[model samples]
Target: MTEHAPTTYLLAGGGTAGHVNPLLAVADALRAREPEASVLVLGTKEGLEARLVPERGYELLIVDKVPFPRRPNAAAARFPLVWRRAVAQVRRHIRDRDVDVVVGFGGYASAPAYVAARREGIPYVVHEANARPGLANVLGARRAARVGVTFAGTPLRGGEVVGMPLRREIVELDRAALRDEAATTFGLDASRPVLLVFGGSLGARRLNDTLAESWPAIVGAGWQILHAAGERNELVDSAHPDYRIVPYLDRMDLAFALADAVVARSGAATVSELTALGIPAVYVPYAVGNGEQALNAASAVAAGAARLIPDAEFTPDRVRGEVVPLLADPETLGALRAAAEASAPAARAGTAAVVAQIDEALGRSAR
Candidate 1:
């Protein structure tokens, strides 16, 4: 009997958690399914993947950080040489590792990986995590073997809604069963409804300021607060019995379990996780970006699974007027929860669907 060779995969992406997290999730799933297979990561030395991929027990291949120049500047003049070098670097890695397939999550490294894979006649897949596709993914999707997206209606060629590949802790979490433990972990009353608030790792100053002004009213309305005030944030924890503020939340699964409702940014991962877990939320789209955050939360708002509060409008008055009222109205909150639950089927199948896509691409390459 002949033994088949182990499949080798080159998973590429990384910069922010938005790109790195999904890439790691898919890598973990691939490794779990086929322990003998080689799962490698391609990233820049400066990216989050440099640290995270190694920590996750995957080999990290270095790539040049070649940013696509937007305007006609000095960098634009040098782009051709830099871009070619990046592509050649990826090609060398592909040749050395004998990579069977390249899966990209869209970052500095992925654009070159896509080019290298195409040049080497290897199949490659693209996963876009936002409703507004990134420039790299947009370019890759044109000739990719398969294109997957976290949200529906993303304007990428051949893109399919594959949801967001989430962390295992989130995917396996049993919120109801873990509520009491989560409440104790945060020193909160599990019997009372808790409003969980966060704004990524650096913390959103807008969210921190607004909450500081309105926590008194929120706690007074019979709801407790469990707020992750970002690592760099200066928001001090108040001595109020119902308010608990922490610098960061290492165990977001527990925080999710204790949360009756959430007030946070509408990042792609955040939106996907909330919808998948059937957690009703009021989203404040970070106003700094190209309006993608607002676009990320649109479908949920349209489905009555969540509410949107623009950054400029997410003031203390708005929280008191809308958020506090919603908390007091259990009927509306229940409806939002039910809507989120109803919308969860597609959101929860992301990891499996992405793996299926990779398998299909491999099969096609073999044929």
Candidate 2:
């Protein structure tokens, strides 16, 4: 009789689709390489990962971790308790389920699991999706066997830079079909160019505020708007019949297909997806975290796939300057679109490397 080795992966992180999606990408890669591999996701119950992860068919394990408390006031006193609870959850999962490599995507949500993996002498790796390491990734870095960085310029100084991990759905979208579907579904007239605006999940308040205020000016210019506003965004209404406001967009393939241009935050995954689809975008990287958002948008802008708008001037003048010109010309739009497409992932072959790493790590652990 032949004996086969067992494989188990514990993916940890949550708080946003951005964090969870990359882990999903890695998981997809892992599964493709080893069809028999068992994968489980560890995240907070209230986060999108708990629902999105399992809904996407991965085993979902809810942990006690919360998003890292950024502001000093309210969550400061409560963090230790959260961390302690999270540690307990990690210990319980690792012991009962027999985790192999506990891969962490960036977020405070992954900290306890990473720490637990370290104490248990289990193989662990950290995958950071941003140019600057987030608090969670940074904490896990010291103990991680080999950190994974998506952006080439990540400041970790130690981890291997493997580039961004993108979902298979996004990477393999049928753009033309999406465009036609989006046009018909959203009542967009294909004759006029579509301007896509969205804020992932929590929505962009400042962006929502400015767009709502500038609605007359935008619509007056004869361009169509397909806006995906966040659930909590209170800035605008569906007052104008031409305006479409949904908290979340179900068909981003359709949304991106409908877009002649995109106005969005330059998150690593967003840029990666945009590049993957070869979509031209006007990037407004949020002005926070030592300008990490600005950094995320930089390569795309340099590659001519996108245009960056400084956060301060992201208002009327700059938006008008950047948005109006592209609205009219097919030649410029075509060039940027081609450039974005050209800059997209070559084969999305990061999966094989990841699976090899996991296999090697587990192999050594068994010794």
Candidate 3:
């Protein structure tokens, strides 16, 4: 029998969960498809990938964090030398590891990885997780062998809507099957519908404050609350039996399983997961960045799969008037859930679609 050389894949991205999580999802898919294939991660020492990539058991390749200079300054003066060094580092990794292709999820490391892969004549793929593309993705898209976007209207060169690659737990979760256990895990009544609220890992002060002032109204409306306040949050948990508050959600699958509806930030992953799971939600777009959060939730809102409230407008009064009434109305919630399910087909295919892109890129390389 003849022996075949194992293919090597270099996935580059990391800074936040938005980038790292998707990169990990594709990596997992690649490994599952070809156990003997080499799966490597390129990331900066300062980014979240420093911890997470290693924790996920993938080999982490280090790259210098070089921010694109917005203005002519000292860092800008030194940008060329630094950028050249970063690209050279990635090129060397590609050559030494015999990398067949590169897949980037768009972050600091991706910018240079894209350049390196291009210089080395190896195919590279780009995955943009936001409705508004980032600088790295914007540049990479111009030459990427294939470009994937999480939302339909994201303007990127050759971009196709492939949805967001999600965590295995989120992808495989069966909310109805897990509801009773999830209810027990959160100490809530399985017989009652639960409202889940969160603001990502750090928690959102806006959500915490609004809930603090308006939770009584929610509880009074016959809904249970499971709020994952950020770890830095100091909002004291009220001792109300129906209202449960935690610093962070280590078990998001359980939280999703218990949630009949959600009130949370519209991060790409959050929006993707909620819609993918068919959970109706009210999105409070974080009032920072390039207003991408609002854009992220737009499709869902348009489809009646979710509702949007600006961060500045997510006040206690708004929650009392709008959110409370929505919770009290089961018919509307059911419709929202159905809309979410209807909008989920594309999202559910994200992992497979990204992996297929990778496979096609590899096939082209072989040819």
Off by over 4 Å in 1: 1-4, 364-367
When summed lDDT is taken over every stretch of 10 residues in candidate 1, the lowest stretch is 358-367
lDDT accuracy of residue 199 in candidate 3: 97
* Pairs in clash, predicted candidate 3: none
lDDT of each: 0.93, 0.77, 0.94
Evaluate model 3: give its TM-score. 0.97
Better model by TM-score: candidate 2 vs candidate 3: 3
> All candidates: CA RMSD in angstroms?
1.9, 3.9, 2.0
Per-candidate TM equals 0.97, 0.85, 0.97
Give every collision pair in model 1.
none
lDDT of 3 at 95: 97
Local accuracy of candidate 1 as per-residue lDDT tens digits, 1-367: 3345788999999998999999999999988977899999999999999898999999999999999999999999999999999999999999999999999999999999999999999999999999999999999999999999988899999999899998888888899999999999999999999999999998899999999999988998899999999999988888998999999999999999999999999999999999989999999999996999999999999999999999999999999999999998989999999999898877888988899899888873221
lDDT of 3 by residue, 223-298 (tens): 9999999999988777998999999988899999999999999999999999999999999999988999999999
RMSD in angstroms between candidate 1 and the native structure over all alpha carbons: 1.9
Off by over 4 Å in 2: 1-4, 66-85, 213-222, 234-243, 288-290, 347-353, 363-367
**Candidate 2 per-residue lDDT over residues 194-305, each given as its tens digit:** 7888867677876787677665566767778888888887755567756677777877778887887888988888877787777899887887667787788778888888
